[model samples]
Target chain A: MATLSINSVRKSFGAVEVLNNIDIEVEDGGFLVLLGPSGCGKSTLLAIIAGLENSSGGDILIGDKNVNDVHPKDRNIAMVFQSYALYPTMPVRRNIGFGLEMRKVAPKDREAAVQRAAELLQIEHLLDRKPGQLSGGQRQRVAMGRAIVRNPDLFLFDEPLSNLDAKLRVEMRTEIKRLHDRLGTTTVYVTHDQVEALTLGTKVAVMKGGVIQQLADPETIYDRPANMFVAGFIGSPTMNFLKGTLEQGDGGLVLRHAAGTLALAGLQQDVAGFVGREVTAGIRPEMLDSGDGPASLTGVVDVVEPTGPDTMVIASVGGQLITARLGPKDRPRPGEPLTLTVDTTAINLFDPVSGNRI
Target chain B: MAATRSRSKLLWDVISYVVLVGLAFIAIAPIVWTFLTSLKFEEDIVTRTMQYIPSRITFENYVKLWNQSGYPVLVINSLIVTTTTVLLCLLTGTVAAYAFSRFQFKGRTQLMLGYLVVRMFPAVLMIIPLFIIMRQVGLLDSTIGLAIAYTSFLLPLFVWMLKGFFDAAPKELESAARIDGTTRLGAMFMVVIPIARNGLLATCVFVAIAAWNEFLFALMLTTSQGSRTWPVGLQLMVGEFQLPWGMLAAGGMISILPVIVLFAIVQRAMVAGLTAGAVKG
Candidate 1:
């Protein structure tokens, strides 16, 4: 129901600055995930948005009005904490209704809202149980129910599912996306898990060392990262970087590595300034396949890691070590020469000095 | 061989039990003796023969202590003074503790260390200055005056112990409460305080016990029954001429009763809270 905008927000704690000129505008009903590694200031940004922390210098707007000085409760936003921050002493029923009660809602109306949220989150049976009595997944649902019952203009989540087990984290991830689709309240979620950012966010903001490296839709963040940091951070078997200088081939520009040269014929980025300069060539592990593609790199397989669905191939190509993803059925043993096909269209180039994409 | 090992283990257990039981008996013998002496008549208590048990149990000693020594008035004064001291100390100490736990202001570490230093000082060393302050305020012999004096001494210890507990309560919970629509102070009272209930309960019992049994300040600050606590009255019962053994023992037992009852009621909570914050709900 509200569009959230942060403009030139800078946060500093005495001598150390945590966030520098953070600006993001989440359109009405947009899901923005602040994605980064640990100490990336993603959680800090979320806290500032929720009014739990004050920005040293900035203006925050919800819809049209500035909410910089507004108290967290008065800002009409609900938050789900990473720890699930449920009242330890209160039963699930009261925990869900606490925000409503704080707002001075009528008891009957509060009960109805609580019931609605409980039913939505499928936690009706656990309503009478204290948080300590519930399992991790159930506590997560209660945390969501607490936020959902508020039905506010925006929802803020601070790594809410990061504490769950891998399987449950996936289940809760899908549940959160489903919830967002149903409610459509503008939401800002923070997580270090790139998979979560890709699956759940409509837009992803990758942060590093208190600065946002990239801000765009998930696919854009994955497929066309603005910098090398985003490209490396947003992938699981993270992007493989090969150091070399850019060269012009007979047909067009090409990235030359010590191992081999990759044709940049289908490269989407402009290669003008990067003509003869040293560059870091990057490609996702998945983009390198076992079969012949438009390009190929012959290397000796160093190790083979079979992870059920896919086999990870770590091979030494020339002097640089590169990893590739292959189908589980194709078993390539270590110490064997393997010629993995590379997809030139999926290649990325970063300036060797700046670490930014060229 | 297994049978021989079992016998040896059993022998060790029996020896350990004998040692433990012997230690326990030694610890309780004095208390038991005092109680027995309190129940005996004055004649029996003063007899040359060491009377382990009262030949004639009498309520006369208890009645004399209760009515004649002005012990009832002293007990009443102690109750009012200690209760008032506990409440005020808790109120001010909790706020100080919460701030110390959550916020880092200038000199916070030094200030906290200063409180710890004050707590370590012997109470007698500060009594003279306290006496001067009491005289200046013209509150020397009043129970209210005694409570205020107890507050000055107890607040630092209360803040130190309770700060450790309040620190155990996650800062995230308080932040959650604030976002849930309560002010910071409101969050402290409603959310943080409730979660730290067991720790708070334990701290309250300790504070109350400390104030109730406080001797030095009570001795110097209070002059008469209007402000005198039980410990002072008990000391008076040990008159310079000769100690009233029966009355003294009765008064000592009475003094320990409240602390024992308080621990009995809240021991589970105190123990439970000790390990509560290990894993969060």
Candidate 2:
């Protein structure tokens, strides 16, 4: 296993800049996932780390050695691509053993390593079959086998589970995590999948528009987002952003809007600087509990979506839509009045114009 | 109504077979006529009515063409030139084709367009320049000179055809090979080329056939008995005074036999390659 460090790396393709001053480092055996939407340069950064594409400026160190001039083959890194990218002409055995053969490992040794990997991946029966004959999930295993057999300093996965169906994707995601646990190799996985990022990564770097928006552990990234973009991008059912003017009420501080004013008396964050200014309140869907108490806010339900475990009710509060993931039993009807008690401490306050968290 | 439809279908099937049989006969008529003429006595070929059958058949024409007429030497020369051209085009053109398909070098599109423009011109248009260069290089009246001429004309088509194959083969395989510790060129030959071998084989057959049946450059560049190809030798036998129809027919049969055999061998491979999804959906 090896540590990977990117030092202010930047990349440009002629005049179109792809990555702008990217800086991230993962310790030995740490799983660092670079997560972002498409066109966010997460893949570009992964490619730069692999030494497949050169960075326009700055340095990359793999295992404490500068790899700016090293070739991908010499970098001692194996990558699993989104397409699987298995060699179609060769059988699964040779596909898994290719890197060992290229490194000039003895035939007997290569055969043994190939066997071990096949058993590990439960692909011993598929050794003689070509990649075309294998199903999508089997191909994915063989691709993983190809990477793991080499036992390189680092493993790179470029959205490796994105091609499978939803059910298979979940199965393969768990399998990948199990493999990482067993191998304990430093790995950098790039994906736009937040669930994969949350489940698989020891550290997650949320990227957007060629910049790292937030780099933290998954829990921290989900709970304390760096900005409005991170708060909006990371969560499912999405966090509701309520536009309101912060005011000093008789009781304490409150956020007043077209919806009923929300009490913010015991907020952990200091809000004295902008008592009268407008701010956006970010609240998670689950944090809004269904209640008809005096403290609860009333809103008209807009849409109801059942997701097996919970039912999501999209409701308009003060003319703004907010989603609440309540008990599946609480299947609120459209146009019905719904009372939701907000979690005061869970509110993530952000400046309206700057989108910076306060 | 169903019974009438079935009866009409039978009629349509009969008409289709008749038309197909008629087309097939027209296609093979020349070859059948040539084979029959080769077996016939010289007297039967000179008849006023086009003789469909000869009362007497003789092997004398084949025997004479194989011995006295230098027909064997002409056949050997054609084989050498065509085989050499096909090999030259397959080896060098595949690499160029792979580059054109995969790499994004500056002027790559322009260079490919230039190759296409060269292909658009008639081979006859290049004959004068090729002939002058052959003479300047002192390779005139040689099989190698003829092979070189064929290579110049056929390589562009080989490169163009194989580029389509290489493009269809994913670039990710080559990238995987590179990461697996193979050089760029090594990955191309060891990985990319093997996957695309059927296309290369198809191109090889086309290049060989184009060079084999070539008459214009073969006629102009090589006038000697030592280097003359079968088509040139056959035309020469149709003398200004009297045509040796039987001997020329025998030589024509010899010229096309190998190409037919080659196609029979490669047809299965090309079909298999097309169906095998190199990139799965």
TM-score of 1: 0.94
List lDDT for all candidates, in order: 0.90, 0.90
lDDT of 2 by residue, A80-117 (tens): 99999898889999999999999999999999999999
Candidate 1 lDDT by residue in tens digits, A1-358: 7999999999998989999999999999999999998998988899999898899999899999899999998999989999999989899999999998999999999999999999999999999999999999999999999999988899999999988999999999999999999999999999999999999999999999999899999888998889888988878788998887789888788777787777777887887977888998888899899866657887899999999999999999887889998898978989999988888888888887888888
Point out where model 1 deviates above 4 Å.
B1-26, B240-242, B274-281
Please provide, for model 1 over B58-171, each residue's C-alpha lDDT reduced to its tens digit, 9 standing for 90 to 100.
978889888778888988999999899999988789999999999879999999999989878888888999999999999999999999999998899889888888988888
Question: TM-score per candidate, in order?
Answer: 0.94, 0.95
- Candidate 1: residue A241 lDDT (0-100): 88
Residue pairs in candidate 1 whose N, alpha carbon or C atoms collide under 3 angstroms: none
Candidate 2 Cα outliers beyond 4 Å, as residue runs: A293-295, B1-25, B272-281
lDDT of 1 at A240: 90
